[model samples]
Target: MGEFLMDKVDLDDVLDKFGVFDRYHAVSGIFLVLGMAWNAMWYFNFIFVTEKVEYRCADHLLPNNTSANASTTLWCANPAVCSEWVYDNPDSFVAEFQLACQEWKRTLIGGVQSFGLMLGSFIIGALSDRFGRKTLIVITGVTGAALGLAKSFSTSYWLYFALEFLEAGFGDVTSPLFTLAVEMVATKSRVTYATICNVGFSGGLLVVLIAWLVPYWRHFQRVLYAPGLLFIVYIHVIDESPRWLLSQGKKEEAVHIIRKAANQNKLNIEENLIDMISCEKDEGLSFFTVLGNTLKSKSLLKRFIVCSVCLIACTFASHGLIINSVSLSGNKYTNFALSFGLKLPSSILSGYIIAKFNRRSPLILFFMACAALCIGQPFIPKSKYLLWLLILTYMAGKLTASMCLNTALIYTFELFPTKTRSSMHALCLAISKIGSITATQTPLMMAYWSGLPTAMFGGVALVAGLATLLVPDTGNKNLPNTVCEAEALEYSDRIKK
Candidate 1:
């Protein structure tokens, strides 16, 4: 009987027994979406609060403005040596910190947050795999929210900068939460869950637009952190991933959770089904062991490298377009909102495409489209109509890049095994942050030549898109349970081709 059960039981089989979109999953999905949205708010909040609004040298710096032309002279004066800046919004971060002259420092504020995200991905991700997904989510979510709230009360620019770093380090909760969310659902529903998470993220981006209504940046910052309070409720309602539990040799606990899930779904799961579930070994592998094992396998190593490149390219292209889009000649608020809004449909389309087709082709096509648009954006003449066309094309590119990013995200999740999923996801995200860091420099590149930054983004994405073709596809495939299983899938895929 034991041999029969062991031979038959797998995660998918269990998921099939319990309803896939049942009550337990619905509840868990709601919390995960909210958590993911909150994470997105923190990650992208810098874009709004630190925006570069129009400014001019202080009144005192200019000669007595007895003549109307003095106003014009003040605007035309060398902005670098301004003693004090008069901004369109006196309450914005640019005005409060007088950061107009220190444009590079302004850019660093965003870059530093990405640095924090990179660190959090590696450190917190490893901890999630070692401890438990729910534990780290609660810990990071609360701490990150507190730090974000503290940032609203910042007394100095340096203090705010420090808080940004800490907030990002603790607030990078999306990856683990996403992993848990995916693990909770059946294999066929993974794309749906991923797309839902992306939609949540897009919702968060739209939420940031509310900053336009607030009178001050600090007030806006406070609003952004308010959602973090949901983590308290999440701690009570969210369950630990049963897969993670099984991997740790906690079969009884895993069974208990599975039964609870089954009960929640109003399905009658057999006692024998729970008994059948078991782990091969529970030696408690560390993050380095997983990393070492992945690197040792040539097949996984190749896949890892390829996925990393895709991640970087997607990060760079998506964020580069978003940040640079603000500089376009139009209402900054509208453009920003429209750029983010494009994600809603893009995500839906991405989910459908990946479900119907394979991962590699759609990803490659999205990247290529983004590259084409970015490469073509600069060539349009600078008339008002032409500039709007340029903005349209750029936004289109953003949409394509966003699709690639969402697709790459699910693809990366499918590429790794259950044991190392969180850790490997974190590594990919950490490497992607390097692309984000590079993206923050787009403004600097624009100062040299407006087209140079977009061209660079296009060129990088082109290379990454071509490289994606080299990786194996996991469409309609079962999630692997171990490193060896993932390697076997790759080997089998190669043989079939």
Candidate 2:
């Protein structure tokens, strides 16, 4: 009888013993998708900057009213007038541009605001682990939407900057969505489902494409307003993650949330099922202790450096193409369309292909392609056809790097312990922003010196290629659950061989 029972208990049987019932609640899934979609608006910030800055600066190059025919002359207004005067007086234009740049440097360094968002993610993730996922989701959604709306209407630069920080801080509600969704679902389906955010992120690029087609800043603002407001309404219907509650030893609340989910799916959960179970204990350390632990973790430190290097490289390459979409000299719309167009299919293919192949292979190949593009870009002369070809190459490189970004996130999250995972991930995000800030400023400065953008993008691609070698392959193996476990893998045959 004992032998027969041992044969009957396979891994599948074990999982089924602990699996969730009524897994397909329509309301819960919809709310999750909507909330994630709302969080995707940050990707659209590139589009916002492109349109707003372009609209403000386009007439800066135009001839003044005094120089043109009276009938043809149109008196400039607001930003348009300030641009005209600056353009007409060549000597003073640089000073004015410098002043404007100084005044709004923080806005340009928008990636710096990512630090605050990381703080919020750390705080909210702990709160979710302690309190409830559903509560934080609703609170974060409403708060983020309110802040986003306030940012849209802020009257002063400092006020607007403050609100932007608030928006970043609260909008991180989606950061925990991965952990939450994976925990709530059955283990078998969790891998594929949690990764749906990759496709959603690509879909967000399409959103930016459509949003960019809006000619002015105000019209674009009006369009984004709806998504922000809608998110708050949808948060009410989502259920909390039962896995989180169970981990925190809140068995009753876990069972309550699970039963509610089951009820919504028209199934019944056993009342005493949760009471019959036991789970491993979690220390639930404070944020500072987590940070200290992460700093002391040699393997985590190595992985963090790898991620940071790749992030800086990827940001430099991707934004080299993204930042130029609003400039006066190039075909802005065509450039944006081509870059964003490549990203959608590229991102989807990456997720699918990476699942089947060794992770390092794709990254290495993409970075090499980027390197080749950089070496060849300088030779291509400035013409519409050549420009389009360059744009296409740039898009291809960005698509590949974007895939690396997705893979890095998955890799980093798995490489750390649960206690310090959020903080470590947040630090990596902040580091990645430093890369983006450099990318934002580098091309404009390069263009000022050389009067060529092709060279700038090419140089960026080269740097990104060098960074690829620093990233470790994180595929086909189980991630270590503790610092000690992770340290053992460092000298494993995979690396030694």
Candidate 3:
């Protein structure tokens, strides 16, 4: 009888493992597709759509003309140029365009809004932890898709501004989604799965490049909506995290989901495998209680602090570069396109480097090194070869950004307990948003005071370099599975027991 029971236990464990793997594969696949579709804007045309159209108009209108008749005359000369002229001077165009792309001092406001999204995601995170991951994923996905689609039709700047905020807020449901993916997957497979999913954000760059080849912003707007629409189809294939279900006291539901996962992975289960006893916490838990417990934990706190600052530094530097590129750099479109294209190689290289080195070390060294290069940028000779050199330096800054984003995501997930994962991740995002807010002005102010973009990038680089050194490493380990595990920890503590 004992031997027979042991055999059943082994079979159950095998089935359970297979189920987790199946779920990871499916969800990762779906998110990869969505990421490829959506994130390209950062690299592709998101930043330049306004600039491209505006420049086209500027080139045609001969600058400094104010009459509607004059604009109309120009428009008649070339219909495409005419359309660009109208968009160029709309009362709200400058503010709406800057805010939309998060450029200049407006980037500060935009960054704050990003924090607001984190706050929104925080609420979403709690509700997800309480209700079910499936519902929030579906709801947020729909909200984001609707907002993105509606944005294309917006007439006035305010209307577009409102939709832009909604689009940013709703699109970020992915923060919690990342936590959910990490929690639902087996301990060993997480890094690989998360990294692969993250590659989707890079894949988005490829799509954006295609959009850049097009001449019109309206068409680009149409292309931007495609990813959000594609995500709607995922509602059928994905479900709530079983870990969340267990935490919410839905043992039977968790079992059903797990069983389904096994079936999806094509694993065979013995009838007696279902008899194995599992630890399932079905008791309703308080959000305050969970939050307090998570914050007070030492190990989790260390991980959180390091992750937060690194993220902030990275965002400030990389996002600042992206936001200020068109205005600061000499050849706006070409520089922007080259910078965007570099993200692919940066992301690919970051993945490999993180897999090979200490996370914190790379972050610290790169920021400091990049800062020196940036400060010296203004001194570069204004020749073709010199311009290429400046571009290379700019690419270095972008590469650091990619490294920071990747490390923060992987490291934070690994450091926090499964129960508080969403909160921790949200907190990191919130801080990064703050960094972005500060960065919005870094270049503009530097230029105004010093009349040099290179000098500005260098100073920002110094700050980022210092911030990167302050954190510890949390890579290549199991995540904390519970709040208790996160709290009773040290620098080297693993979130998972």
Candidate 4:
């Protein structure tokens, strides 16, 4: 009787009975999304830290006049070599360190920070898959924040930058939390869970922008880094993912966690049914096996490349549109907040649309619509003549791009099997960072052509939309536990010769 019951029970079937958003998941998700809101501050902190500082030459770069001061000296047609600079904002790092002529140093700090974040994604994602999600989340989340707070005391530029690198390379809690969120819910409810977490991400960005009112960098750092420590409490509150536990062949432990959820949801699950549950094991902890399977499978490899291209476009456009959104003539802080406001709303709408229809069509539509909006940007005349029109058009692009990114993440997450899902998603994120890095330098393209940045964004988005057609739609599929199961994710569209 036990053997018969064990053979008949499936994990998803048991979980679906708990209902997608049960009280257990609700309690777990509260901690996870709050962690997201806290993590978002550090992730986008560079936008505040590297803000442009107003400066002027102290000496020879200006015309020789005894009356010349900081403001009057700025009119110099050519900003030649300068031994020193005067600044308006004394608390700014640029002013504090006297980084008058070395603009690249300022920019390099941002680049180094990004590079560290990229590396963190790879290391933490791999570790989470092997070590367990709750452990890494507590360790990395607190450690990263502590390192970031430590940077507040650095007296030298290089020392401050070193802390920046270390803090970022320490990894984030949100990645593993996101992995846990989808796995905790039913297939039909995955989008709902993912978007709610994403809203928390945007919420963090909004929270950090308020730091513009903090007055001092150290004070903001303290405020930003302090909340992250609260995540350490997750160790006691949250347990390991039952799906991951089952994959690792820890059936008794997985069943214990399931029982907790059943009790919280008040579901009268059968004791015999629970007793007969079995765990599913996949290819070992080796990430190589996952990659090897992809390399060998023709359809998966094709789908892999297609998802990569879409991710590239999503990351690139999302970053580029953010910079453009703030470049409009207005209060940079207000503009930044309003620009990203659509992020939260669009994610909710996109999740509904994807859950209702299918993944491929909405993704294709969002990407294509973003392409159209961005492509027409240069022809829209100057902000002075039609300010609302300019903001309206580009903000629409930002909205669509935000939708594209959220959907792309869910699509990629659904594409791979559960065992390697976090790492595979991380790899895609790491690859997509190339586009992110490139987008940062895109303003340089304007030296060659005034409209080049907008043009490039449109081009990549168009390519991503077109490339998406080659891949299968994952809307109708369940989370695949094995590579073979994932191969049929084309909504049962089997490979044909």
Q: Is candidate 1 or candidate 2 better by lDDT?
A: 1
Q: What TM-scores do the predictions have? A: 0.93, 0.75, 0.76, 0.92
- Clashing residue pairs in candidate 4 are none
What tens-digit string does per-residue lDDT give for candidate 3 at 1-497? 88655642322243335532365466546664464446445223335443422322444544355554445444545565433333453433343453322234333335434554656655676666666666766666666667767766777655665766666666555665666666666555555556656666665555445555654555566666656655565567776666666556565776687677667666666545544524456345556666676667665566667677766766666666766666645776665555555555665666566667746666566667667666666566757767777667767766666666666667666666666666667767766666666665555475365335445555655675576554445555445556655544443433332
In order of lDDT, best first, we have 1, 4, 3, 2
lDDT of 1 by residue, 444-480 (tens): 8876888888888788889989998888888878888
lDDT of the structure predicted as candidate 1? 0.82
Output the worst ten-in-a-row residue range by lDDT, candidate 4. Answer: 68-77
Runs of candidate 3 exceeding 4 Å displacement? 1-30, 39-46, 49-116, 206-219, 268-278, 282-289, 327-334, 365-379, 449-472, 488-497
Say what the RMSD of model 1 is: 2.8
Answer with 1 or 4, whichever has the higher TM-score.
1
Q: After superposition, how far is residue 397 of candidate 4 from its true place, in Å?
A: 0.8
Task: Pick out the ten consecutive residues of candidate 1 with the lowest summed lDDT.
Answer: 65-74
Q: What are the per-residue Cα lDDT tens digits for candidate 4 across 1-497?
A: 86654665667777778665678888887888788877877876766776667776666445554444544435444556556667768788778876765666766666677677677878878777887778888888889878988988889899998898888778567678888888877777788889888888777665545577785777777877877777778888988888888888888888999999888888889887776666776556666666676778887788778888888899788877775555667987777787777788888999999999879899999999999998987678775879788778878888998999999999988988888888888777767776777776665566587667877888899999999989888885779987888887764855532
Looking at candidate 1, what is the lDDT of residue 247?
A: 85
Provide the clash count, candidate 3: 8
Best candidate (score: TM-score): 1
The C-alpha RMSD in Å for every predicted model, in order, reads 2.8, 6.5, 6.8, 3.1
Error of 2 at 45 (Å): 3.3
